[model samples]
Target: MKLRLILSFFLFTTCFTAFGQEKKNAVIVEKGLIKVSVMYPYAEGKTFNMEYYETKHMPMVAGFLGANLVKYTIEKGIASGIPNQPLPFMAIGTFYVKSLSDYQAAIAPNRDGIRADFSNYTNITPVILVSEVIK
Candidate 1:
């Protein structure tokens, strides 16, 4: 009876542990999907308003992209891999879309308005990269 009790407890623990270790469902993007990355390189005396970016800027951009925008992510730099080293980018905004041409068409009419709103947030001239998601 003692051996049976110990074995049951061990089995229960092992099952619980296995269930707890299950991996999270990750976002999956197809290989040919378009990825647009906007990076703001870090600089001394440069300013970034994370609040405005999150609340106003990104939403506005996403709205402009409309149905063409699959999904998006915003990242704020906090630390460098090397201790005491300056972080590379102040912030990064990336969006995934099905077609690059569709994204361009959606943004064309709103480009002027989008550019105009930049001053409401930061002074950084954002670096833009358009690429295909290979992974």
Candidate 2:
């Protein structure tokens, strides 16, 4: 049992080092309870409306989500880590929230409106994930 625990700890540390985790202060750690990432993948002959996504969609999301949204950041992808490589995603929107329940409750009432507005952004289906913060 002791050996297994030590092995698990070693693996976790190795993975953390490989991923290059950012060092954080206590305040930042407490602020991040959960993370939601929405990724718009790149595809040949596809279009994405940066203006609509940033200006219109995000505003609507803020209204619907309100206090549930602790903080959010949107990033426009330029290139991948590989030299002279195309980016896998056109854009990524990350949301930090306190809990899964809060996110779900916020989505429940505004799910239809959010879904309907998707057509205004891009044709490609977005990839989304909700992750609990390890710290």
Task: Estimate the TM-score of every prediction.
Answer: 0.80, 0.73
lDDT of 2 by residue, 2-120 (tens): 99999999999998876665444223635457888989899888788989999998778867677777777789888998998888999988888887897889889888998899899
| lDDT at residue 38 of model 2 (Cα atoms) | 89
The TM-score leader among the candidates is 1
Query: CA shift at 95, candidate 1, in angstroms?
Result: 0.8
Give candidates' CA RMSD values in order.
Answer: 3.7, 11.0
In order, what lDDT does every prediction score? 0.91, 0.83
Q: Look at candidate 1 and give me any clashing residue pairs.
A: none
Error of 2 at 23 (Å): 16
Off by more than 4 A, model 1: 1-26
- Window of ten residues with lowest summed lDDT in model 2: 22-31
